[model samples]
Target: MAVQGIVTAADRIRELDEINGGLADMLNHMGQAIKALGPNAQAGSDDLDARKEVFQEHSRAAYVCTQAFHARMKRQVYALEEAGIILAQAHIHSATSSAKHKQANNQPVQGQGGAPPVPPASEAEHITNGGLGNLDVGWLNSRGNKVGMEKEAELLQEAKILLEDELERRRGPAASAG
Candidate 1:
């Protein structure tokens, strides 16, 4: 959903760019006409008025597109927030389950020898220690809970790239100049 929202926002941004280009062309043509005809010239004034009306239409369209882009961005943000919440919940569930498993294993069962309970290693420790690569994710696959996580990661990466491209485009030549 976030990826789709980014795409929708990007499309709206492109529409705004095209509309702005048309508006700029109209302004340039109007300026050239006025300069060529002088302020008092009435020839083709009706055409100029029609062009002004078209420019206004383009401006209104651009405004609507801008609003749409803003809405899509908000939706993307909401989607991301929801995804974060879900991931956090999953993490907490995993931690709780791991703790329970460790506790159960540490208990002395009937007929078991009275040896000291060995401290069980935890997946959460690996996660907290920043060892995501070492973190056990097979449990997720077995439970069918994170089957689409890889695809989600890819979509998020694409969204990030799209956003970066849009930001760079908005920055324009000034970013390169600096």
Candidate 2:
């Protein structure tokens, strides 16, 4: 747990450093863009260069810090991953041991004299209205009031009749016998 905490802290620090480095890069780009646009840009090359050098120094420092943080955090992550594997194996071993222990205990337990309790029955109930009491399959094909869907319902009914006629034509006894 302590190691996990340490690893978590290291991970956070690495993430923060990475974020800081990105922000620094963005700032550097903005600074260069501004210097490029301003009228006295060429005349102030020396001053701009000095400012650029300072920025470079800071950027390099940030990069070095991020790299170091990553290296350290990577080790911690590796250790944490290893610990997880070890912990999983330990749990498996403990579970098996517990199962054996339980079996040993249950040999005498033999529940109340002869056997364990039986489970209850599960009946699958039928539904109506599509579901209990609301089983309205009127919506199976559509949802429209008798007034509002008159045209659409007529078209659908005609379509269903057409489908039935087509199906019967294709599946008639003479068609199948051939």
Candidate 3:
């Protein structure tokens, strides 16, 4: 059981790493797209030039905000990955300790005994109880965490809403032109 927990945590960490990589790639693409727009105005008239300036300012601001957001998200993802590592280590340590304790008494490694050794508090619990930093790995895996299902659902809903809003904004100009 403890081994299974460790495996599961390892798998989750891999998944999160993949997700973080994809997000970083997306941020890089966004930055490249913004840069490709060029800073100099290509408008022919004074009024158009002024409008282009305003548009450039807004685009720069948005790009900066997005970069900041991406940086923060990356940090959070790294922290979560670190937490998973810690949890997996703890599981392995616990299992090893249990085996050693049983061996000293000449007991079977996996058989009815005086009860199994207590495992360390889960990674989610460690974070929640303030043993570690303030991160919600429970949302990633609620196996042993005290997190409510609703919280995870709410997070997914929020992400969906943000994506939908971005899609709508992107389509607005095209729809108006048509």
Candidate 4:
């Protein structure tokens, strides 16, 4: 009876570990995908309107991807919590069995003989302590985002300068009186 419970809990723990690994892999891939976006977007005046449209579309797509990643990560966290619970139960079972084993040898059930160990905090506890947003860029207003944001602003400034230069280069002479 108790043995079966122990086995079930162990199995649950292993499954959760696997899920966590897969989730980490997905998060890594998403990071790489976001990085695949090119840099130095300095389109000429002729293409300014087109470049603006492209930037807007990229922002929208990034938003959707960010949301999807958040949801998947949340599910992974929940799975980790579930696994922690199963592991705690397994620890209890092991302790109880040890107590039974001790008693069979005419020893006291814990205290007078040996005490069962308490389960340590789950790794999830360490992770959840610092919620999200370390790397998430969904909330642009966050001061934590200033680092890369400053660089982005600089890039945009350069693009604007390039557009002005292109405009000047393409400008024609003003028309005179007929």
Query: lDDT per model, in order?
Result: 0.54, 0.53, 0.58, 0.54
lDDT of 4 by residue, 10-80 (tens): 66566567656655665655554454344434433445555556656655655665666577666655555
Candidate 1: clashing pairs of residues: none
**Which numbered prediction scores highest in lDDT against the true structure?**
3
For residues 55-171, what per-residue lDDT tens digits would candidate 2 score against the true structure?
Answer: 566556556655665675656555544654222122212334444554765643233566542211121132222222332355543664666578788999999999999989978
TM-score against truth, every candidate: 0.25, 0.25, 0.26, 0.27
Residue 63 displacement in candidate 4 (angstroms): 0.9
Best by TM-score: 4
Candidate 3 lDDT by residue in tens digits, 39-145: 44344444655655555665565566567667766655565656653332222335577677668877666645656554334533443323334445664575654
TM-score for predicted model 3 compared with the true structure? 0.26
Residue 3 lDDT in model 3? 70
C-alpha-based local distance difference test score of model 4: 0.54
lDDT for 147 in candidate 2 is 67
Ten-residue region with minimum lDDT total, candidate 1 = 84-93
